[model samples]
Target: MTTPRIVVIGAGLGGTIAAYEINGAVGNRAEILMISDSDTYSFVPSNPWVAVRWREPEAIQVHLPPIFAKKRIGFTSAGAKRIHPAEKRVDLNNGESVNYDYLVIATGPDLAFDEIEGFGPNGGHTVSVCHTSHASEAADAFEEFCKNPGPIVVGAAQGASCYGPAYEFALILDTELKRRKIRDKVPMTFVTAEPYIGHLGLDGVGDTKTLLESELRNRHIKWITNARVTSFEAGMAHVEEVADDGSVKSKHDLPFGYSMLLPAFRGVPAVRDIEGLTNPRGFILVDKHQRNPKFPEIFALGVCVAIPPTGPTPVPVGVPKTGFMIESMVTAIAENFVEILDGKEPTHEATWNAVCLADFGDGGVAFVAQPQIPPRNLNWSASGKWVHLAKIGFEKYFLRKVRKGESEPFYEKLALHVMGIRKLKM
Candidate 1:
C-alpha cells in the first residue's frame, strides 16, 4: 500500500506549527511536506516592535530548512502558484506540481494596500509594519521623523481584520517619543473604521472599549472612529466619518509627518476565487471541523479562513483569528487526521477561543473570549504592566518552541489545562 501524503501550504505561524503537530500525530503512517514562499519564518506579532527598533528583524526570524530536515519532513520554498483542489494537486511557481491525499491551506492573508490610493509603503507616502522588511524601513523613517517631529497618525483601515497591532504600534510610538522627550512636539491621531474605540472586530470583549479609550485619553491621543480613508497625499489624509446609518457624517483633512495604517486583508492568489472553496473576499470556506465542504481532503486554519462579522456595523469589520484560536484549529486538524488514519471518520473540532496580550511599550491590555465571538461563555479583560512582560515572555517561549520543533509541550498543555483553556472541543 502506498503511504498517504499530507501537504501543508504556507509556513507562517499556523502552518508551521500545524506541520509539527501533524507529524507527531500521524508518525510514519503518512508522509508530511511543507510548502512555503520563503525558507525563513518571521514572528509577525513582533513586527510592531521592529518598527520602533525595540526588536531587530533577525531576533524574530527562524530559518526553516534546517529545522524541517531535522524533523524528517519534506520542505520546499518554491511556493504554490495555484491550488487545483478538484485534482488534489498544487502547482508550484517553479513549474513543479505535488499531489496530496490531504492538504492543509494556512496561507495568511495578502495585504490590500492598493485598495486605498497612496496608502502603503511601496510608492505611497505612508509607512507599514505588516512585514519585517517593511518594519525595518519604518524604523529608519521613525529615526528621521524624530529628528524633526510634527504629527503622527496610526490606526486600521476599513475592512481590516487585525486591530491589536495597530493599537500596539500607536502606543509604542507614544512610549518611544516620550522616552526621547519629543512627544510634546508631535500630535498623534488614531483613525479607525470601528464604530467605537475597542470593537476589535469581536464587538468589544469585556470592557475593552472603556479600557482602550482610557489608554488613548491618558496618552493624549485624539481619535476618529467609523473613519474611511479615501486617499493619502504627501502629508495629508482624506477621511470620511460615516454615521450609524451608513451615510457620510463629516470629512477631515488630517496632516501627519509620519503614519502607519493597517490595511485590509484578503486570501492569497493561490486559492482565491474558487467557486465553492472561497467566499467573495477570497477567504477559504470551512465547516465546523475546519474542512472545506467542497473538497473534504482540503482543510484550512488561521487568517485565511473565512469568518463572518460579529454583527452589522456602519463600517465593515472582520473578526481576527488570534494566535491561540489558530492553534485550536491546528490541534483539531491534527487529531482529525489521526482519526482518519485509524479507519474512523474525522470528528474533532477546535474550541476557537481568543486569548490576546496586546503589549503597549510600558503597559498593556489582555483579554480572553471563550469562543472568540459575542455572547460568549467567558469574557474577561485586564490591563497592567505585567501584561507587557507576559507578551515578551510569550514571544520568547513561542520562538523557543519553533527552534526545538516542539508543539504543545507538556508544560504548555498543563498550564492551559490548569487554566481550563482547551484547544479542542470536548
Candidate 2:
C-alpha cells in the first residue's frame, strides 16, 4: 500500500498546531507535508504589543523549517500559486506542484485593506497590526505620533469580522498614552461597525456590553458604533452611522493624528474563487465535520473558513472564528483523519466554542461564547488584572509549544481542565 500523503497549507497558528497534532495522531502511518509562504510562525495575537513596541517581531516569531524537520514533517516555504482541487494538486509559486491524498487548508485570511480608500499602512492614512511587517511599520508610526500626540482613531472597519484586536489595540493604546503622561493631551475615539459597544460579531456575549462599556468609560475612550467608514484622507475619516432599520442615521468627519484600523478579511487568492469550494467573498465553505462538502478530501480551519454574520444588523457584522475555536477544528480534523486512515468513516466534529482573551496593558477582558453564536451553552464575560497576566502566559506557552513541535502538552491540558475549557468535549 502506498504511504498516504497529507498536505497542510499555511504554517500559521492553526496550521502549525494541526501539523503537530496530526503527526502525533497518525504517527508514521502517513507522510505529512506543510506548505507556507514564509518559513516562520508568528503569534498573531501579540501583534498589538508589536505595534506599541512592547514586543519585537522576532520575540513572537519562530522559524518553521528546523522545527518541522525535527518532527520529521516535510516543509516548503514556497506559497501556493493556485490550488487545483479537482486534480488534487497545489501548484507552487516556484513552478512545482504537490499532490496529496488529503489536504488541510489553514491558509488564514487575506487582509482586505484595499476595500477602503486610503486605508492600510502602505502610503495610507492608518496603520495595521494584521501582519508582522505591518505591525513593525505601525510601531514606527506610533513612536512618531507619540512625539506629537493628537487625536487618535483606533477601531475595526466595515466588513471586519475580528473585533478583539480593535478593542485590544484601543485599550492598549490608551494604557500606553497614560504611561507616557500624554493621556491628557491625546484624545482617543473608537469607531466600529458593530451594532453595539460589545456586540463582538456574536451579538454581545454575556454582559460584554456592560463590561466593555465600563472599561471604555473608565479609560475615557469615546466610541461610535454601527459606523461605516467610507474613506480616509490624511488626517480625516469619513463615517456613516446607520440605524437598525438600515437607514443612515448621521454622517461625520472625524479627525485623527494617528489611526490603526483592522480591515475586512477574505480567503487568499490561491483557493479563492473556486467553484463549490469558497463563498463569494473567497472564504472556504466547510461542513460541520470541517471538510468541504464538495471535496471530501479537503478540510479547512481558521480564518480562511466562511462563517455567516450572527444575525441581520443594519450593517453586516461577520462572526469571529476565535483562536480556541480554530484549535478545536484542528483537533477534530486530526482525529477524523486518523479514522479515515483506519478505514472507518470520519465522525469527529469541532465544538466551535469561542474563548477570547483581550488584554490591555494593565488589565483585560475575556469572554466565552460556547458554539460562537447566540443562545450559547455558556455565555460569560469578566475583567481583571489577571487576564492581562494570563494573556502573557498564553503567548509564552503557545510560542514554547510551537518551538517544541508539540500540539497539546500535559500542563496545557491540566491548565485548561482546571479552567473548565475543553478543546473538544468527548
Candidate 3:
C-alpha cells in the first residue's frame, strides 16, 4: 500500500508549527510535505519592533529548508496557485501539482489593501508591518519621518482581524519618538473601526476598555473610534466617524507625515471562492474538529480558518486568531490526524483560548481570554513594563523553537500547565 501524503500549505507561525506537531503525532505512518512561498519563516509578532529599528530583520527569521530537511519532511517554495479540493491536488505557481491524501490549509491572510484607495505599503501612501519586508521598508520611512516629524496617524482599518499590532506599533512609535525628543512635534491620532478603544473585536477583554483608553490618554494620543477610512492622500487621511445607528457623525481630513494602518484580511486566492469550502470572505469553513465538513480529509487552522465575530458593532470587526488560539487549533488537528490513522473518528477540539502580549517599546499590555470570545470562564488584562520583557522573551523562545525544530517543548508545556492554560479542550 502506498503511504498516505499529508500536505501543509503556507509556512508562517501556524503552518510551520503545525507541520512539526503533525509529524510528531503521525510519525512515519504518512508522508509530510510543506508548500510555502518562501523558505524563510518570520516571527510576525516582532514586526512592530522591526519597524522601529529595535531588531534587525535577519535576527527573527529562520531558514526553513534546513530545518525541514533535518526533521525528515519534504518541502517546497513554489507556492500554491490554486487548490483543487475536489481532486485532492494543489497546483503550484511553478507549473506543477501535488496530490495529497490530506491537506492542511494555513495560508494565513491576504491583505485586502486594494479595497481602499492609497492604502498599504505597495504603491500606497501609508506603510505596513504585516510582513518582515514591509517592516524593513517602514523602518526607512520612519527615519525619513523623523527628519521632519509632523502629524502621525495609526490604527486598524475596517474588518481588520488583528488589532494588537496596530496598538503595539502606535505605542512603539510613541516610545521611539519620545526617546528622540520628537514626540512634542509629532501630533498623533489613533483611528479604528472598533466602537471603543479596547473592544479588540472580542468586546473588551477584562478591563481593556479602561486600560487601553487610559494608556492612550496618558500618552497624549488623540483617538477616533467607529472610524472608517475613506481614502488616503499624500499627506492626509479621509475618515468618517460613525454613530451607533450606522450614520456618519463627522468627517475629518487628518494630515500626517507618517501613517500605518492595518488592512482587512481575506482568504488567499489559492483556496478562495470554492463552494462549501470557504465562506463568502474566502476563509475556510471548518468543523469543531478543524476539518472541513464537505472534505473531511482537509483540515485548516490559523487566520485562514473562518471565525464569526464575537458580536455586532457599528463598524465591522473580526475576532483575532491569537498565538495561543492557533496553537490549540494546531494541537487539535494533529491529534485528530492520529485518530483518523487509527481508523477512529476525529474528535479532538481546540480550546481556542487567547493570550496576547502587546508590547510598547517601554511598557505593554497583556490579556488572557479563555475561549477567546465573550461570556468566558476567564477574561483578564493587565499592563506594565514586565509585559515588554515578557514579549522579548517570547520572541526569542519562539524563534529558538523554530530553529531547533521543536514544538511545545517541555518547558513551554510546563509553564502553561502552571498557568492553567491548555491547548486542547477536555
Candidate 4:
C-alpha cells in the first residue's frame, strides 16, 4: 500500500506551521508535500522594521529547502493555479498537476493595493511593508526622504485588518527621524482607519488606546482617526470623515512626502475561484478545528480565515489575526489532522484567545486579550525595551523550532487553554 500524500498550498505562517507539524507521520502512513510560491517565508510581523532600515529582508528570510529536507518533507516552489478538491489534484502555475489524499489550503491574503486608489500591483506611489520588496523600497524611500527632509504621513487605509503596522510605522518613523536629527523639520501625521488610536481591531487590547494615544502626544505625532483615505495623488493623501454607522459621509485631503499606508487584503487569486471553498470576500471559512467548513479534508489558518466583527468601533472595523492567534490555529490544525488520520476524535475550542506581542518602533507595547477583540478579562498591556527584546527572542525561538521540526506541547496547550478561557466556558 502506498503512503497517502498531503498537499498544502501556501508557505505562510499557517502553511509552514502545518508542514512543520505534519511532516512526520502520525503513525507512519502519510507523506506531506508543502508547496509555496516563494522559496523563503517572510516574517510579516517585523516588516515595519524592514521599512525603517532596522532590518533587511535578506537578513531575515531563510531558504525553505534545508528545513524541508531535514524533516523528509517534499517541497515545491511554484504558483498554485487551481485546486480540484474532490479529485484530490492541484494545478500548478507550470501546468503540472499533483495528486494528494488530503489538502490544506493555507493560501494567505493577497495584498490588494488595487482596493485603494494609487496603491498595489502597479506599486503604491508611496512605499509599503506588506512584502519584503515593498519594505526594501520603503527603506530606499526613507533614505531619499532623509537626504531631503519633508512632511511624512503613515497609517492604514479603509478596510485594513492589520492596523498594528500602521501604528508601528508611525512610531518607528518618529524614532528614525529624531535619530537623523530632522524630526522638527518634518511634520508627521498618523492617519488610520481605526476609530481611534490603539483600537487595533481587538478593540483597544490592554490599554492600547491609552498607550498609543499617550505615546503619540509625547512624541508630538499628530493623528486623524475615523478617516477613510480616498486616494493618493502626487504628494497628498485624499481622505474623508466616516459616520459612526461606518459609511463615508464626508471627504477631505491631506498632503505628504513620505507615506506607508497598509492596503486591504483579499483571498489569493489561486484559491479565489474554487467553488464553495471560500467566503464571498474570498477568505477561507473554517470551523474551530481550522478545518474548512465546506471541505473536511481541507484546512486553513492565519490571516486566511473569515471572521466577522464581534462588535463595532470608532472606524470601519475588521477582526485581526495576529501572530499568536495564528499559531493557535496552526496547533489546532496539527492536532486535528493527527486525530482525523488516526481515526480518533479531536476537539479544539476557540473561546478566549489572546495575542501577546510587543509592538516595536518607539520602545514597544505588549498586549494580552482575555477574549479576542472585546468583552475580555484581564486585558493588561504595557510598553518598554524589554518587550522589544522579548519579540526578538520569540523570532529566534520560532525560527529554530520550525527549522528543527519541533513543537512544544506546553506552548500549544497554553494557547488552547487561553482560548477556552476567553470563550467563558469551563
Candidate 5:
C-alpha cells in the first residue's frame, strides 16, 4: 500500500506543529509535505519586544532548511494560492501544483490593513505589527520617536483579531520611555474595539477584566474601550468613541507622533470561495476536533480558526490560544488525522485551552484558566524578575524544539488541561 500524502499549507505555528507531530508520532504512517512562502518562521509572540527594541529582528527569525534536513521532512518554499478540495490538489502562486490525500490549511491570517483605509499595501497611514516586516518598520519609527520625543498613541484598531499586542505595546513603550527618562514628555493612549479591558476579542480569561484594568491604572496608560477608529492621519486618529450608556460620540481626534495599531485578519486569497469552507469573515470553520466540516481533508487551528465570541467584550471575555493552546490543537489534529488514515476513529477534542504569558512594563503576568472560559480555578499567577527570565527561557526552548522537529506532548497536555480545553470526564 502506498503511504498517504499529507500537505500542510502555511508554515506558521499551526502548520509547523502539525509537521513535527506527524513526523514524531506517525512518520512511517504518512508522507508529510510542508509548504510556506518563506523559508523561515518568524517568532510572532516576540514581535512586541522587537517593536520596543528589546529583541533584534534577525534574532527571532529562523531558516527552515536545517530542520527539514535533520527531521527528514519535505519543505516546499512555495505559496499556496488555492485549494481544490474536490480535486485533492493545491494551487501555487508560481503556477505549480501539488496533490494530496490530506490538507491542513494553517496559513494563519492575512492582515487586512486595507480594510482600515490608510494601512497596509494601500499605503494606509498607521503603523502595524502584523508581521516581522511590519514590526521592524514600527520599531524604527519607535526609535525615531524616542530620539525626537513626541506624543504617542498605541492601540488595536477596529476588527483586529490579535488584541494582546496592543496591550503589550502600550506597556512596553511606557517602560521604554521611562528607561530613557523621556516618559514624562510623551502621552500614550490605548484605543480599541474591545468593550472593556481584557476583552481581548475572546472575552476575558480568569480575572482578566479586573486584572487588566488594575494593571493599566498602575502603569498610567489611558485607554478608550469600545472605540472604533474611523481612520488615521499623519498625526491624528479620528475615532468614534462608545460611551458607557451605549451612546456614540462623533469624530473625536487623538493626536500622536507615533502609533502602532493591530489590523483585522482575513483568510488568504487562495482559500476564498470554497463554499462553507470559511466563515463570513474568511476564517476556516472547524469542529472541536479541528477538522473542516465541509471537506474532511482540510483542517485549521490557532488564529486561523473562526470562533464566535461567547458574549460581548465587557464580561469575563473569552479564551486566547497564543502559547500553549495552539500547540495542543496541533497535536490533537495531527494524531486524529493519522488515526483516520489508519482506519481508527478519532475521539479527541480540544477547545480554546490556553496559558498566555503577557509582558508588562517592569515585569509580566501569567494567567491560566481551564476551558479558557468561566468557572475559573487554581489561580497561579506571579510577576517579577523570575517571570521575565522564565519568559525568555521558554522562548529559547520553544524555538530549539521547533527547529529540531521535536513535539513536546507534555506541554501540549498541560495546555489542554490547564485551559480547560479538556474537562476531566467523571
Candidate 6:
C-alpha cells in the first residue's frame, strides 16, 4: 500500500496543531509535511501586550524548524506561491512542488490595510498590533507618544472581523496611560464599523453590549459606532457615521497624535480567486466537515475559512473565528481524515463555537458562544482580573503546547470538560 502523504499549509496555530494531531492519529502510516512563509510562529494574542511593551516579541515567538524536527514532521519555511487543487500540487516560492493525497490550508488572513487610505502600519498614519513586528514598532511609537501625550484614536476599521483586539487594545491603552499618569493629557476616541458597541460580529454575546459599553464609559473612552473611516491624514481621521437605514448621519474630522486601527482581512493570494474554493474576498469556503465542497481532499482552518456575518450593519462587518473555534475545526479535520484512512466517509463536524478571552492591561473579559450564533445552548460573558491572569496562562500554555508539538493539552481538556464545553457534540 502506498503511504498517504498529508501536506498542511501555513504554520500558524491551526496548521501546527493540525499537523501534531495528524501525526498522533496516523503515526508512521502517513507522511506529514508543513509549509510556511516563516520559520517562527508568534502567539498573536500576545501582540496587544507586545504593543504596550508589557511583553517582548521574542517571548511570544517559537522557532518552527527545531520543533518540527523533534516531532519528525517534515518542515519547510518557504511559503507556497500557488496551490493547484485540481493537480493536487502546491508550488513553493523557493522553486519546488509538493504533491499530496490530502491538503489542509490554514494560511490565516491577509491584512487588507490597503483597502483604506493611510490606514496601516506600512507607510500609513497608524500603528498596528496585527503582527508581532508591527507590535514592536508600535511599542516604540507608543513610548515616544507618551512623552508628549495628544489625542489618541483606536478602533477597528470597516469590514474588520476581529473586534476583540481593538476593544482590548483600547482598554489596555487606557490602563497604560493611567499607569504613566498621562491619561489626563490624552483624549481617546474609539471608532468602529459595528452598529453598536460589543457587537463583535456575533451581534452582542450575552449582555456584551451593556458590559462593554459600561466598561468603555468607566474608562472614559468615548466611542462612535456605525462609523466608517474614510481615510486618515497625518494628524486627522475622516469618519462618516451611518444610520440603520444605511444613510450617512454625520461626519467628523477627528484629530489624533497616535492611532491604531485593525484593518480588514481577506484571503491570501495563494488561495484567492480559486474557482469554487474561495469566496469573493478570498476566504476559503468549507462544508460542515471543514472540507471544501468542490474537493473533499482539501480542507481549510482558522481565519482563512469563510464565515458570514451574523447580520448586516450600516457598514460591512465580518465574523471572527476565535482560537478555540479554530481548534475545533482542526480536530474535525483530523478525525475526518482518520475515518478516511479507515475506509469510511467523513462524518465529523466542528461545533463552530466562539470562545474568546480579551485582556486589558489590568483586567479582562471572556465570552463563550456555543455554535457562534444567537439562541445558543450556552451564551455567557464575564469580566475580572482573573480573566487577565487566565489570558497570561493561556499564552504560556499555548506556546508550551507548540514546543511539545501537542495538539491538545490535558489541562485544556479538563478546563473545557469542567465548563461543560467541547469541540464537537460527539
> Which tens-of-lDDT digit does each residue in 1-426 have in candidate 5?
888888888888777877888777776778888989999898887888887778888888878877877887888887888888889999888899999988888888877777665554236666777787788888887888877887777777777767777887788888888899998898878887788888776556656678777877887778888887777777888878776565675557888888788777777888876787887777888887888887887878877777766565421122344656677788778778768977987667764455666776577666664556554453334345444555676667667777677777535544334334455321
The weakest ten consecutive residues by lDDT in model 5 span 312-321
Model 3: per-residue Cα lDDT over 1-426, one tens digit each: 888999999999899999999999999999999999998999999999999999999999999999999999999999999999999999999999999999999999999999999998989999999999999999999999999999999999999999999999999999999999999999999999999999999998989999999999999999999999999989999999999999999998999999999999999999889999999999999999999999989999999999999888888999899888898899999999999999999999988888788898899888888778888988878889978887887787789999998877422353354334566332
- The residue pairs found clashing in candidate 6 are none
User: Model 6 over residues 1-426: C-alpha lDDT tens digits?
Assistant: 999999999898788899999888888888999999999999998999999999999999999899899898999988999999999999999999999999999999999989889988889999999999999999999999998899999999999999999999999999999999999999999999999999999998888898899899999989999989999999899999999999999998999999999989999999999999999999999999999999889999999999888877899998998887888888888889889999999999987777777899788888888868776887888788877877887788788888878877323453354334566342
- Candidates in order, TM-scores: namely 0.97, 0.97, 0.97, 0.91, 0.91, 0.96
Candidate 4, after superposition: displacement of residue 354 in Å?
Answer: 2.5
The superposed Cα distance between candidate 2 and the true structure at residue 70, in angstroms, equals: 0.7
- Residue-pair clashes per candidate: 0, 0, 0, 6, 13, 0
lDDT of 4 by residue, 1-426 (tens): 788788888887778877877664353568889889988987677788898888888766778888888777889998698887788789998899999888887887888788778864255577888888788888888898888888888888777888877887788888888888999988888888788788887778778899889888998888888888878877888888787876776776777788888777788877786777888778887777777767778877878778886566656667778766676676676777677777876686444366555455547777677667567765767778766666666666666665666655323344334333345331
Candidate 1, 1-426: lDDT as tens digits: 999999999999999999999999999999999999999999999999999999999999999999999999999999999999999999999999999999999999999999999989999989999999999999999999999899999999999999999999999999999999999999999999898999999998899999999999999999999999999999999999999999999998999999999999999999989989999999999999999999999999999999999999998888999988899899999999999999998999988888888899999988888789878988878888977887787788888889888877422353344334565332
Which residues of candidate 1, in runs, are more than 4 Å off? 409-426
TM match of model 4 to true structure? 0.91
lDDT of 6 at 166: 98
Model 2: which ten-residue window has the lowest total lDDT?
Answer: 409-418
46 in model 3: Cα distance from truth in Å? 0.2
TM-score of 2: 0.97
Error of 2 at 137 (Å): 0.8
